[model samples]
Target chain A: MNWYRKLSIKQKQVVWAWTFLALPVLFYVVIRFYPTFGSVLLSFQDWNLLGSKTWIGLENYEKLVADPVFWKVFNNTFIYLLLGTPVSLLISFIIAYHLDKVSFLHATIRAMYFIPFMTSAVAMAWLWRWFYQPVPVGLFNNFLASIGISQLPFLKSTFSALPSVLAPAIWAGLGFQIIIFMAGLRAIPQSYYEAAQIDGVGPWTVLREITIPLLKPTLVFLVVFSSIGFLRIFDQVFNMTTNDPGGPLNSTKPLVLMIYDTAFNAFDMGYAAAQTVVLFTILLLVSLLQLYVMRERT
Target chain B: MKSWKKTIIGATAGAVMALSAGFAQAVEIEYWQYFYEARVTAIDTLIEKFEAENPDITVKHTTFPYADYRTKVAAAIPSGQGPDVVQLFYGWLNDYVEAKLITPLPTDAFPPAMIEKEFFPMVQAMKKDGAYMALPTAVRSLALFYNTRLFEEAGIDGPPKTLDELVEIAKKLTKKDAAGNITQVGITTGMNAQDHHWWREVLTRQFGGDPYKDDYKTVNYNDEAGAAALKWYSELETLHEVTQAGFMDEGQAAFKAGRAGMHIDGSFRIGALKSTRGLKWGVAELPAGPDGMKSNYSSYWVNGITSKATGEKKAAALKFLAFVTSDEAMQIWLDTVGELPAKPSAALTDANKADPVFGPFINGLGYAKTTIFANESGQRQVIMDAMQRILLEDQSPADAVAVAAEAEQKILNEYYK
Candidate 1:
């Protein structure tokens, strides 16, 4: 008890700071940091979930580099990011811009758009899959057939599968992005828009000169956020094309799904860890690249 | 009044003591399975009976979704928290054996001679390292399920007997609108997953090629015959225009909805198919290949004790397993789940064989082959992809098979190594 009173004020402050940080620091070490290091170490080893782990010294990585499926999944993960981010951002921004001016049932309309984001990804994937089925069973095909148009294969054809999967993914993410955009729009001073109106400036000109410039922060944040979301996409692709996951011929397969299949289905933990390390590197690089690209001009 | 109070106190103490004693003496063993309505109900009833019979032991039941079951088991068993007794697909036997996750049955309890005499030939799947690692209550084999009304409407007199006849009948049965959209499908094949299973287990055999060789260590389906089978399976979609890969939610949905004429499925689906309102369906033996070679698949889900269980828990699990695979449980499974009994004596009885809906599957027991593929799901995906390349990407079947064989061979090579 007497030892407690012997500490200096600076020491006491240090002790308190560490005491407050201790729980989170311990948590990060145990839950987050431990697994990260373990996976990195495992990347260089060979272990099937059941057997003893062996030190293969980069053999798993060599295999990954040589694997054709890994390359396809790598290309797919990027396509998801490149296509999903810009398309969804444009859509949500457009919806939020128009929705901000509407007075009637504003909350209801906003809630309707946001509901999909809150809904289960598995359910959403299955629903979208149902909509993509052939003529007699699928909604899209039936509607097309009724309108005297040819039934287009949404999920069956390899050329159409990646984009078809991207549509549902983009839809599922719009609600949160729209809410952020709306908040950004709301924060902009109304007087700027009023002045622009008094000067006889049109909506498009005001949007271009003032709104877009002011909303750049929100835009940049969402672009990075949505890009990561798309890059790590698994549930939609897994659930929709579950009969043969990763899409037909792996057209819709992403990196994370490949990691899951490798780890769980194949039980190749070391190989799976290597793939996960690769995914982690890609995510880090992409996020950093986006942040650098969107840095302030001044 | 004092006497009455003493009596009540004494009785309360005794009751509390009895309850605690019961809790202390009871042993609990958990049983795990994938979610299936009929399978669950049948097992629940059997578990109730088991608990009643063995007063000192309690059994807890757990079920995960079908797609996640194997993964959950693989993760759980290694963590020391898996179920004491587990129901696993027979295809996983090799993986489990290699991983040392499950123990072989004691010979005293399940003697090899007894097993050979009692169970069907597929029981060979349970033997690893010259001992039985698992035992099953029910077994299933794929059979041809055709919509009777659809066949009659299409002017087909009988189910096709050969692969070429199937193509002809499927072409006749397919119904298309003026816009060239298929309204009714003849069969479910092409890139669909079921197509791959049928191809690997049935068509590959018919085409005189095997999926794997040398104790499942070599990929044997990369040759001309494999290419011919894959090409034939895809012809249902491309050549005949009968059904495309995306025709229904899957093959079974098409048959249930009366939109498909012929579907290849296991006897496990009979209970559900029988209840489909206003649908007239009939089961036939799977058609032979071009060479008139007959082959079919027998897939079984067996219950085995995990290696994590030991001592008293292991003993209790064995008792549970014995009860589950006994004649009574087999009868219960046959009556309720619409699956063939794994026990040869139980299944080959005249009364059971006379059953029209289940008869074909039971008869298939004679020739059905149970594949010991280590990762059935992964291998299925490989074949499905090969089919997709042929149908959607216009890849030649020979090239597609070569590619699939290369990928599948990689998996086998790793396993064997």
Candidate 2:
């Protein structure tokens, strides 16, 4: 106790601060960081869950590189990210922009948009699956038939399956993105828009010069966040294609689904770990790239 | 009055403590299976009987949804947890053995000769290195399920006996709208469903081709006969236009909706079909090929003692397993689950063979073949992809068969080698 008293005030404050930080730091190490490093190590070994792991350095990686299905899945993951992020961003922005002006039943309409985000992904995917089914059973197909238009094979064709799957995914995410955009829009001071109006600038010019420029930080954050979400997509695809997961010639199969199939279905833990490592690297690179590109420049 | 009330509470607590002390000495083991209502009820009844016979032993039953059951077993076993006796699909037995998740049944308790003499020959697929790794309580075989109302509406007397007649009947039963869209299909075809098994075990054989060579380690369905089978199956959609793929989402769903004339499904479907209101369906033997060849696919869900079971738990698990596979349990499963009994003694009775709904499925067992799967889902995916290529991409039947064969061979080599 005397020794603690002898310490300087700064040192005492440092000791108190670390005492509070100790628990969460320890938690992050044990719960998060430890398994991450373990998975990285397992990527170089050959294990089938129950069997003893044998070191087969880089072999799983080699096989992954050569596997055509892995490449196709990698392409699909990027497609989800590229297509889902921008379309969701634009649609949500448009809705939030228009919705900000509407006062009648405003809260109720906003709540309606947010409901899908709260609903279960599995339920939403199944609902969308029902909508996409062929005529006499499906909603979309029946409507088309009623209108005298040829029925579209929404999920049956390789060309249409990925987009059909992406549609619901983008829609499910709109609620959350709209909420964020509205929050961002609300944060922008009305004085700037009033100034633009005083200058007699058009609405488009005001949006381009004031609103969008001010909304840059929010856009960057959402871009990174939603990119990661799309990259790691699993539930919607898994549930929609439950009968033939990643089917129609693997058109809708993403990297995460491949990892799941390899790990649980095939019981090839080593290969799955290798795939996980690749996914982790891809996620890290994509996030970093987006951040770097969107970094503030003076 | 307060003291009297306290005394009553104290006495109740004491009695509970004593009962728990008795339970503490009993060996407890868990059994897990995928949740199906009838199977769950059947197992609960068996558990009640097993406990009554052995009051010193206690058993706990667990079930998960079919989608997550295998994953739960795989994760739990290596951690020395979950299910002393676990139920697994017979196709997954090889994976379990290779992963060391299950232990071989003791030959002393389950002699190989007795198993061969009593159980159907198809059960031999469970044998590895002269030891039985698992035993099933019930077995399943494929049969043609025809909607009686649809047949009557089409002016057909009965189900077709040959493949050519099947096509004729299907074409007759089909209905179309003014826009050339199919309103009612002659039959349902989806490779994602039982059609993969039908093509591999029945059609391929009937077309004079073996699906696999060398105990299913090599893909041999790349030949002319295999291509012919593929062509015929796909032509049901392309040329005949009697059936369509993905109609009403699934083949069974279409059949159940009374829009399909015929559906090929396993005996396990009988229980569900029976409960579907207004569905007038009858079972028949699968249509024969042009050469009069008949074939069927047999499969089962088997119970095995996990490696986690040892000593007292192992003994209890074995006792429970033996009871579940006994003749009495088989009868209960057949009654509740509508699956055929695993053993000839229980399944070959006159009543089972003569019953209208069960007779066709029972007759199929005599000519059934079980494929020793290296990777069942992967192999199924190969066939499904082939079907999709033909239906969607205009790929030739020969090319699709060759691609599927090569893809399946790679999976087989990955496992066996």
Candidate 3:
């Protein structure tokens, strides 16, 4: 009360503004920061969800380095990220651009594209599993047969399984990226397009010069989020592959799946946590690297 | 002197009060089980009957789904919060017993002589250290489930009994289109293989190789017999060209849709098959291996009264266990669940023998064995993972077996030494 009385009107307003901001900061600390810190601590110990923990310094980290399975799963996860993210972004950006052009159908087409993101991952994975079934009677295989193409091993082949999983992952993820890009595109001042038109720019040149540059922030965000999603990929691979984790010779296994297997199946929680820390570091470094690259480009 | 007399009186009064309170309170026994909706209903009915009979004691029932039950039990027991009576898979017996987490019942409490006379020798031999840690309630085994409609279309008579005959039937049953793309599989393998340890165990046994030594101290499956077993398994996809890799679920669907002839699965699949209308099917034992060994690994759902239980509560739990293992309860279970009764007196009945769906199970039980539970979880995982790698990845059996043996030995040395 004394401080407020002593302060000028502007200083009082600044204090009120900070007080309002403090609430959200407190909320984040309680809900997010605390749990994140706790998980970091947990990563150093051997714990089952129900049991007492045993502390084992960096033994877990050491073991993770030697685990062949971890390398294979990590490779699969990177493959998923590499194959899924760009394809998704490209498709989404194109669709968003075209939908923006269509004045009347923009809303409906946007909604249609967003429907996959709205659908549950479990349900989508189940549907995709049925479609990827390996026999002639299977949905996709039947379609392939009608066109006289031999049935491809969509999930079972070690060479193709990661890409096969990526298809559904990309499909499920496209809607979000599309909506994000659409929002970003809508925010682009129409005056820029008009200026480009005055310069006699073609459609492709306008897209490359103006649209891509303007949407850089959104693209960077999508890349970061999608990279995180791909690195921790678990549910679809687990459900669709009958909990094989690494299906048909460690093809579809990802880092998260590896963590789950180590902790639950092998009862090596310390090692699992070590792997999780490695994943977190990788994610952090990648996100930072992306932000730096994007900022430099700008 | 007066103060001393007062102190002694106070102590006596306190002791008397405690005794009276103890007598007034009824003993409570905790029972844990894993049951689906129907089994839960049946068990609840049985509990009602048991409680009505035992008026002085109360039995608290806690249940979980099959998938979570094992982990729940493992966690609960060590925390001193485990139930006084528990149901478990027989495979978990050694692990629990080795930990001394379960109390072994006295041989006199069971009708031991009668059990010896009636039950299969293999069933009784599962016990260790001269004490039975668990009593089997229901049993299941692997069998060849064949689609009758597909067999008729292929002009085959019936299921084969030998490997050569199986191969011959498989070749005929396989349907390839003009372009040589496989339209239908003759057999399916590796479905549920990750969780279903029985399949690998049965195959290992049929190859005339025991995966674990009798003492449970060493693994013995790296020999020629083990390699032959694995090779034969791989040949289903690699050599015979009857089944394709990763076609297990598809083959099951096809079999259900009347497109495939044979699929190997456990007796638990009866309900799913029965639900598929207009599909003619039959069950037979898995084909014999080169050594004419027909032994297939089987598993049992078991029940046991805990050591923590005592007095009237113990009696009540025992009564319920006895009833579930009794002829009447076995009949209800068999009729409702289509599971083979573990008790000889119940399983050997005319009704069970006459039922086609359950008959193969009973026959298979004669040749059934179980993987040796050596009280080491790591060893089990290592061996099972190796088998999966071989079957799924087409790793040479020799290499797989060698790795598995080495891993098993390492685990044994670390944990059991």
Query: lDDT values of the candidates?
Result: 0.87, 0.92, 0.74
- What stretches of model 2 exceed 4 Å from their correct place? A1-9, B1-17
Q: Tens-digit lDDT track for model 2 on B45-105?
A: 9999999998878889999998888888878988989999999999887777887889999
Candidate 3 TM-score over all chains jointly: 0.83
Clash list (residue pairs), candidate 1:
none
Q: Model 3 over residues B100-126: C-alpha lDDT tens digits?
A: 677675677765566666556656754
Model 3 clashing residue pairs (backbone): none
Candidate number that wins on DockQ, 1 or 2? 1
Docking class of 1: medium
- Winner on lDDT (1 vs 3): 1
Q: Candidate 2, what DockQ?
A: 0.63
Off by over 4 Å in 1: A1-23, A194-205, B1-12, B190-192
Give me the iRMSD of candidate 3, please.
Answer: 4.7
Q: lDDT tens digits, residues B1-417, model 1?
A: 999899999999999999899888888999999998889999999999999999999999999998789889888987889799999888776677777889899999989888988898778768876789999999998888999999998789988888888889888889888888999888876444455667887888788888778877788988888988888887778888877665777878888999998988888898889879999999888898877888888888999999988999999999999999998999889888988899988898898888777888888777887776867667888888787778777899999999999988887777777
Worst 10 residues of 2 chain B by lDDT: B92-101
